[model samples]
Structure formats: structure tokens, C-alpha cells
Target: MKAIVIGGGVIGSSIAYRMSEAGADVTLVEARRIGGGTSSTSYAWVNACEKLTSRAYFELNWAGVKSHRRLAEEFEGSNWLHRPGVVQWQGAGAEAAGFDEGDFDKLERLKEWGYPAEKIDTQTLAELEPDVDLSTFNPEGAIYYPEDGWLDGPVYAGAMVAAARQRFGLKVVYGQVTELLTRNGAAVGVKLANGETIEADTVINSSGRWANEAVGNADHELPLAPTVGLIAYTVSGDTSLRHGLRTPLVNCRPDGAGRILLRANDIDKTLPFDTEAVPSNPAAQELLDRVTQLMPALKGVHVEAVRTAIRPIPADGYSAIGPHPALSNYYVTVTHSGVTMAAFIGEGVTDEIVHGKSVSEFAEFRLSRFF
Candidate 1:
């Protein structure tokens, strides 16, 4: 079968790699550089802890975490998958952040669900993250998720595309997909902005925030409530921080090469959709201040890069996958946790397309619900 995948972010890259590995001729088209979209700016935290809205969604995310482990084993190394674990704590009064009663209840539920979690004291927390300053917050309510980690999205996506190219001859095209091509009520392929047409037996739209645009005149619409997020990358500095940190003030993790990634839920709301990097932007400066307060080792390390992108969330705030209700040959797999679910979605979609198997896990995420 010939398959055309729109978007070259982590989800699309994974699908392309899996489809090509399954012996399907696949062509992945990207408007910009691979992994340069939301994936590049994401925190890329791989965990199901925050997905307690529904059991199915939580299970899906859990599968994603496991899939990452399996992928690392398959690749014989985890250079792109950092499993240092994550340590999160909450503060009181004005310093309060996550880990409220609701969050703690969620942690208990996760533990009951067999997910790895432990409520650690201040001493244990210090031993786990020596570089972090724990004097400001009470660590009695802190939680540690031993299985959770972060992903270097760009690196992982690039590696998958490279593996697909070297092992299965996957073709990647760099151009804006102007529209989806349909004939006789079935998706036939895609049309590029340059008027080039590439035909295929199936078309999958994994275009992140651009899913609706990629659908174009197709008889299907993907409603996305995308949100803007900003992340700051710090200059390489001296810090012994190994685990992903979620304190009352900020969320941070190592970005490899001695650098660190910092972001805050509160800061994201203050940012505009078209925010540009102006060296001393208040939002970026606030991130620097928060991280410095947490890890004094980063005192002199300045913000090197500030990236802002829209998070691709379905209208209902859940994943939307499976074939289009009206367009049988057209499929879509877009969600908010693209980093965590990429591997699982890739394998599931490939099974449905190449081997003619129905993925039961995707039954709850079908696009037909919105129609």
C-alpha cells in the first residue's frame, strides 16, 4: 500500500517509520524542518500522571510510556530517552503550585493502578536531586514518579526518520501540503503548494496544530483548541540536576550538553500567540529567576533560547484518532500528548492500515464522535 502522511513532527515521523517498516511505501511531507514544530518546544515529559481525566486516556498514555521503553530496548540504547525520573513538590500560600489534594489523590489512584510512585520526605528528595534547593518548600507532600522521564523530541524524531530512511527507504518531502486529494469519495493523495501531486492509497493527517488546514476541502473537519506555550533553554552550566523537577515555581529538566529546559504553567498564560524572543522579555526573565531560586548552580546561566508554540489539543481535550467518518481512506491521529503517545499511535495506526486489523484502543478516540 502507498501511504502519504502530513506533518513531520514526532507523531508523523513515528507513523512514517512504522508504515515503511511494515513494507508500505510511505511519503512524509513537512512544511518546515522535521520536529521544528510544537515537538521542539515541548517539555516532552513521558508520563501518565497528569492524564487522570479518564481511564482510557490514562491507559493510552501509560502504553505510550511503556512503548518508549520498548523502543529504547529495540534500538539497543536510549540516547534520546532520558529516564532520570521526575521529582515534584508543592509549596504553601503564595508559593503554592501543583500537588494539591486533588493531585495527591490522583497520585494514590496512580499507585493503585500499578504505576510507580512514592511520597518522599525532604531528605530523600535532597538525595535524589542534590542540586535543587529544597529549603523553600515543605517536602512532606512531595511525590516521585520513578518511571517517568523526559524525551528529546527533536533528536528522537530525527532518529526515527533516519532509521526509516536507512532501513526501509521511506521518502520525505519538504513542502506545504495545500490540500488533501480525494476522488470517488476516497482519499487518493495530497497536493503540495508547488502544484505537485503525490498520489497514494491512503492519507494520514498527523499535522499537530495544522490538522484542520491540511484537511482543506476534504469532507471532514478536525476541531482543535490549541494553546500557546513558552519554554526557555538555558546556557550550558554547572549543575548536578539529573531528574525532571516540578516545583511550586517552575518545571525544569536537563536538555543534554549541560543545558536545562525551564517552563511554568503561569508564564504560558501571559504569553501571546505571536511572541518573539527579545533577549530580556519579562516572561523569559521570570523563568530564569524561578530556576535560579530552585537551583543556585544556574545563578549565572542566562537564557539561551525561548521557544513558543501552540499545543495541538482536540476540541474535547482528548486524542482524536482513526479513519475519517466521511473519508474512508483518510485517517487522523492528533492529540495533546504527542511526545508520550507517538510510538503507540504509530504502531497502532500501522497495524490498522497495513495488516487490516482494528485497534480496540482507538475505539474511544475515533474522529466520528465529533461528526
Candidate 2:
């Protein structure tokens, strides 16, 4: 079963790793090194706290943390990966009330694989992050998911790509897959921008922003629309946020530092990706100000850098994985959360391709349901 996986982002590399593991002859194709897409720019969070009511998304992300742990153990010597428990804060307004009723119970299992999290009280919250000006918020503390961790996105993507090539018998092709080769209304293989075509029985469109394009190349529509998400990090002085924090208040930034990444939760409305301007939304500065009130550290850090990126979020805004509707043999696995969830069930993608199995609840993500 020779497989050609296009795009070398986390989702692409992960799918390739999974295919090779299942004994499928895999070939990973990329225009650049792995993790070059939005995967490289993500503020990697391994938590399911954001989805209070969305059980499906919660479950998928919860599963992703376990997947990363397996990789860490499998490659024990690699420090490129590890679980860094996530601490998210909600301040002022509803977030100040702190945690939805079912939050802890829903997220408790997230720590089972050595990643443990707990809900801290206001006093504990104060101690953990003294720099946060919890004055506006009642400082009700936040939920912590210990089983969660962050990884160098590109490095992890590269590592998985390496394993697929060196450890597993997989071939990786480098070029832009400008077109999908089809015959009798079915996907056969991909034609790169360089005019190279490799025939195959299966093709997985793991391309991130270009997902819809890949499907269109096969003369089909997958109902996916491309949208952009941006992340900009600023270098700073000794600021305070140690645990990663999220707010339900006016703030959209998740505050922490390895260089505090800002404006993670809002869309850069002024700079639509299709336009290509990809501007640093001036609104981000305001969003940063709002988040700093919860974590007072912004009281003193210098603005270091702000980077912008675009990702293809699903129309339903959930990660997608399933066979192409018209062309059954072709498949797609795409999402904005690919950085977190891809590693978790990354193997499941390969399983579906190699053995025709289903792991995630697809009633919501199924490709045909949209058509």
C-alpha cells in the first residue's frame, strides 16, 4: 500500500508517521521542511478547557495529550517533547466566577498520563501569579490540566517526519502538489508544481490552508473554506504569568511567556488572508491590554516581536478527518487545532486509510453530511 501524504505540517507529518507505523508504504510530500505551516506558529496548548459544551472537540483534544505522551516515551531521549501542564485563567465578568460547573470533572481525565491539573482557589491563584492584577477579576483561580504539555511545533513535526522516513519505510517528496491526478472521476495521485506526477492508489489531502484546493484538484468540493488565525509573540522583561491563562472577559490573549504570545483567540479582521496583506491587526494591542489586567505582568514587559500567520479552519470550526465524499479512496484531515490534536489521534488517520476504520465520532465531522 504505497501512500502519498501531501503537506508537511503537523497534520501531514502525523498522518505519514501513522501510515508508516501501520506497515503502509508511505511517501510524505512537502514544499518545505515539516512544520512549516501554521503549525510552526501556534502557541501549543494541550488542553480541552475551551470547549465546555462541545464534548466531541473536548474528547478529541483530551485524546491528543495521550498521543504526545506515547511519542515522548517512544523517543525517550528526545527533550523536544514533554507535557507542560496548562493553567488557564478567566477573569472579570463570567470568567471571574471561574470554571463552568462540569469543567473539572470533564477535564480531570486529561491528566491521567502523568499530566495532572487541579482547580485552584483565589488565594492559590494569587500566589501562583502575583504579577496578574486580579483586582478586576474576583481572582477565582482557574482549572489546571497537568497531563498537558507544549512542544516545539516544527521540531516535533520534523521529528515525526524523520521517523517516518528513517525508522519506518516511508518516502517523502518535496514539491508543491499543484494538482491532483484523477481518472474516471477518482483521485489517482498528485501532480507537483514542478510537473512531476507519481501515481498512487490513495492520496490524503492533509494540506492545511490548501485543503479545499486539493479537493478541487480532484474535481470535487469538500465544503471547507480557508480562514486565517494569527499569533504574535513579544519578548519582555521579568513579567509574571507562569501558568498559561485564558479569559472569558473582554480579553482574548492567553498569557504566558517563553516570550508571551498574544491575541490567540480573536480573528485579525482587518487583514483577511485572501487579500495577502496579513497585517498585524492594530486591535491586538487593545486585546493585550485587556489580558494584562488579569495577569499584571504586562505592567512591565517590553514588546519584542509580533508574528502573523493564516490557517484553514473548518467551516464547522472543528478538526475534520474522513474520506472524500465523491472519491472514497482520497481522504482529508484538517483543523486549526492540528498542533494539539494531530499528535493525539494522528495514528487514527493512518488507521482509517490502512484498515478502513473510524476512531473519532464523525457525525459532526463527516464529509458527506455537509453535501
Candidate 3:
């Protein structure tokens, strides 16, 4: 079947790769450069230890983490994959929204849920990350996940698309999909911004934050809440970190080279909800200061850039995948943790599309839940 995959971010790149591998005539369409959108600015931490709300949701993210390991092995030469694990700690009060200590009793609950979480004291925390100021960062100890890690979304996406093109004859078109071509209430193709049309038997709307607009073009509506998040990149530093740190003030991870990528839920609260603009100078400085406080190694590291991008979060904050209820031959998959779930979701969704099988693990996260 001739399939057109929308968006060229991490999720779309994974889907395109998996679909092409399954012998489908795949075409990936992107409005701009691949992975230049929210994927580029993502924190990209692949973990599920702190998602204590729902067991099902936790399982989904956990599966994504494992899938990433498999991808790292498959693409052993790719420098974007880093599996150094993650360390997270909360403040004295209920400051963090999702990672709040009060929620589900925090570390105790994580251990009970069969998730690998180790409580570390200040000395142990210092041993894990010698450069970080553990006394000021995690005074009351912290939870560390040895299985967690991170990836470079843009680099991974670019690699996937390049492999798909060379191995499976995948066609990549660069232009905005202005409208969905339909016939007798079924999607047949897409009309591009340059007035070009490409016919396809099926179209998958994996357009991240733009998935809602893509749905609108197809004469349907998806209830998506695209929230904004600010990510700041710092200049390369001499001191290195062994794990991604999530303190109450800032969350930071190593950016392959010696640079660090920083963000915080507290800082994001001060910014607008759905803006495409970059963060202000003051906000950028504030993020740098917060990270430097946690990791004294980055005290003088310059803030290279700050980007504010709308995260692809469904209205209910769960995933919305599978075929559209109203539009035939069209499917969509979007969620908040796109980086963590990309490979797993892509592999599962591709099987459903090409082999006529349903991924049992993703049953709860289907688009039917919203409809």
C-alpha cells in the first residue's frame, strides 16, 4: 500500500522507518526540515519510574524505554543514544506538579510498583554525580533509576529517515500539507502548500503539536492540548555528569558533547501555554542559574540558546492513537512523551497498519478513548 506519513519528527521518523521496513510504499512529508520543531527542543529523557499515577501508563512508558535500548543496539554507531540513567529529587514542599513528593507517597510507591528505584543518601548521591552539589540539590535524599537515559531527538529522527530512504525506497516531500484529499468520506491523498497532490491509500497523522491542525484539514477535530515547554542549551563545560538530574528547580541532562540541556516545570509555569516564540533573555538566564545551582560544575557555562515549543499533549494528557473514528484510512498518534514513546509506538502502530494486528498494550491509549 502507498502510505503518506505526516510530520518528520521523532515519532513520524520511527513510523516511517517501521512502515517502510514492513514493505509499504512510504512517503514522509514535512513542512520544514526534519526534527526542527518540538523534537529539536525536547529534554529527551527516557524514563517511567516517576509516573506513579497509572500502572497502564507506566507500563507503556517502560516499554518505550526498553524499545529504545533495542534501537541503540540496532544503530550501535549512532552517537545520539545515551543510557546513563536518571536521578530525580523534589523540594521540601509540593513544588513539582507531576514529580511531587506528596503524590503517591513518592519513592515508597515507586518501589512497590515493581519499578527499579533506588533511594540514595547525600554521600551516595555525591558518589553517583561528583560534580553536582548534592547537599544543596537533594538534601533529603533522592530516587535514582539505573535504567533510564536520554536521546538526541533531532539526530535520531534524521538518522531514521535517512535509513528508511536508502533501505526501503521511502520518498520524503518537504511542503505543508494544506488539505486532505477525500473521496466518498475516505482519505485518498493530501494537497501540499505548493499546489501539489500525492495519492496514498492511507495517511497517518503523527504531526506532534500540529496533529490537531492536520486533523482539521481532514474535516475532523482532535481535542489536543499542546502545552509549551522551555529548553535551554548551555555551552560546553569541563565538568561532566553521569546521570540526568531533576531537582526541584531545574531538570538537566548532558547534550552529547560537554553541553547541558536544562528545563524546569517551575520555570515553564511563568511562560505562555502555546507559543512558538523563544524564551525571553531573563527567563533564559533564570534557567541557567537554576541548573548551575544544582550542578556547580556549570557555574560559568554560557546559555547558548533557549527555545519555547508547544509540546504535543492530548487534552486528557494520555496518548491518542489508532484510526480516526470519522475518517476512514486515516490514523493519528500523538502524546506528550513523544521522545520516550516514539520507537515503541512506531513499531506497534506499523504492525497494526501493515499486518492487520492490534497492539494489546496500546488498547487503552487508542483514539477511541477520546471519541
Whole-model alpha-carbon lDDT for candidate 1: 0.86
**Model 3 lDDT tens row, 1-371:** 99999999999999999999999999999999898978898888887774556778887888887888898789758867787778877775335434665333666667776777787778888788898875676566777888788888999899999999999999999988877888888889888878899999999988888886764453466787766688888878887687898877778888857888888776676777654444456777888887777777677678887788888888898888888888899888888888888899889988899999998768888887667
Between prediction 1 and prediction 3, which has the larger TM-score?
Answer: 1
**RMSD of candidate 3 to true structure, Å:** 2.1
Q: Give me the runs in candidate 2 sitting further than 4 Å from their true place.
A: 92-117, 216-219, 248-258, 264-271, 274-281, 295-300, 360-364
lDDT of each model, Cα atoms only? Answer: 0.86, 0.66, 0.82
The candidate, 1 or 2, that scores higher on lDDT is 1
lDDT of 2 at 307: 56
Model 2, span 291-348: residue lDDT tens: 5665565665444555557666777777777877877568877776677777765677
Rank by lDDT, highest first.
Answer: 1, 3, 2
Question: Candidate 3: TM-score?
Answer: 0.93
Q: TM-scores, in order shown?
A: 0.95, 0.84, 0.93
Q: Which of the numbered candidates is closest to the native, going by highest TM-score?
A: 1
Kindly give the number of clashing pairs for every candidate: 0, 13, 0
